[model samples]
Target: MSEVKLVAIFAENKTGQLAAITQALAQAGVNIRWVAIASSEAFGVVKVLVNEPDPACEVLRAKGFMFSLLEVLAIAVEDQPGGLDAVVKTLARNKINLRNASGFVAHGRAVLLIEVESAAKARRILAKKQLHILTQEEVMEF
Candidate 1:
């Protein structure tokens, strides 16, 4: 149940925004492990998990980008039908509210990134049910 940090950027939904942000990080030698972008007609939020959070943040700040660090949970789920559904239902039944979620498949397993109201509580609840919660090191290795 270690802490995982996600770098969230608030930017306008226009050309070059994402590129600029990513380019700055890249130039600083920050390796991005995962990224999710959600946008509306006017603005967007770019969330990323990088190898070096501090360096990435510094690069973003030096580049004049508005962003924040978000603590999130990375859970390991089975790569099959009903795997994600079961986890969501368990959290809902336990009174855990899911704020944001994104996932990806790697090495034949599904990694679910969830933003919850109480990450520690959610982690305990999930663990009690035998769900595998990935550690920060495990996530970074991906």
Candidate 2:
């Protein structure tokens, strides 16, 4: 099991904000694997999983956007009913708090990137349940 650092960038709620950020990544040669965005009238937060989180953070920071880095678990689970529920239930049983989660399916498998209370513990828990936790290189391959 391995953990990857996710970069969440907060930008003003206006046109061209997301484009500028993405352009920066593109110019820097960073490959984005997964992304999610949430917003309100005031601002927006973009959560991104990329090949180079540190460099991504630097690029965004250099552009004057507010951002933070977080450690998240990227687990590959069976793509079937109850797969997500089983993982959630297991975390609940262990009193692990999940701050956020996002995922997508590829080749009949579900890859979930979750922000939990403890990365190590979460990895151990998932491993005990026979789940494949992805490393940075593995995630990039997806």
Candidate 3:
């Protein structure tokens, strides 16, 4: 499991916007690990987990893109039935709210990146349940 920093950029919902942003990151030599985009009628928010978030932020800021930095949880769970269900159910039982979640399976492990209201509480809950929680250094090493 690994914990990575994500730089979420907000931009206008217009043509060439996403391309320009991606180009900036590419030119800066930043590698994107995972990404998600949500759009409204007027604007869009692009959430990107990258190897170099600080530099990526500088790139986007120079391009005049509004952005934010968020610390999130990246956990590796068993790639089997009930893997996600177990975590979700546990959080639900503890009344922990999940803001956003995304994941994929690779090499028989389900890697989940989630944003919750409280990282400490979430980590505590997961630890109490004996689940593995990723650290920032671990994520960067990957």
Candidate 4:
């Protein structure tokens, strides 16, 4: 499947909050593949892709952290400028509104991870355009 699970941990904007989260995950032996932190004045969302999401979620629960599992598309883009724009344009043309998006380069591949209103439909549209979508195992390999 092209859908990959992302762990979105909601945290307060305080010192050492990130460290605590990572520490807990490390203690639980969860390998984080990618992570992004976005914050406002008082709160933040820590999004992460991990090697083992189910166990990671359990660890977060045991640690009293509030988080959710989000299914997102991992699209393979060109590892160059405009690579992301190209995918965005295609989605825009199809009237697919992206809820969230981020990118990373790993294993010599440029990946665009995105959350949309309808993942299945979006996948179909992107597939028609010849965009490569990463499978679950493929994403973990990175």
Best by lDDT: 4
User: In angstroms, how far off is 120's CA in candidate 2?
Assistant: 2.7
Q: Mind giving the per-residue lDDT tens digits that candidate 4 earns over 58-131?
A: 99999999999989999999888789988999999999999999888976779899999999999999999899
**What lDDT does the true structure give each of the candidates?**
0.90, 0.86, 0.84, 0.91
TM-score-based ranking:
4, 1, 3, 2
Q: TM-scores, in order shown?
A: 0.91, 0.89, 0.91, 0.92
lDDT of 3 at 94: 94
Which residue runs of candidate 3 sit more than 4 Å off their true CA positions? 1-3, 140-142
Q: After superposition, how far is residue 112 of candidate 2 from its true place, in Å?
A: 0.7
- Work out how many backbone clashes candidate 4 has: 0
**In model 4, which regions exceed 4 Å deviation?**
none
Q: lDDT winner between 2 and 3, please give it.
A: 2
Question: Which digits, one per residue and each the tens of the lDDT, describe model 3 over residues 21-140?
Answer: 899999999988778998999998999988877789888888788898888888778888888888888889999999999996665677788899998899899888878777766665
- The positional error of residue 76 in candidate 1, measured at the CA in angstroms, is 0.9
Looking at model 1, which ten-residue stretch has the lowest summed lDDT?
133-142
Worst 10 residues of 3 by lDDT: 133-142
Candidate 3: residue 9 lDDT (0-100): 89
Q: Candidate 2 regions off by >4 Å?
A: none
For model 3, how big is the CA root-mean-square deviation? 2.0
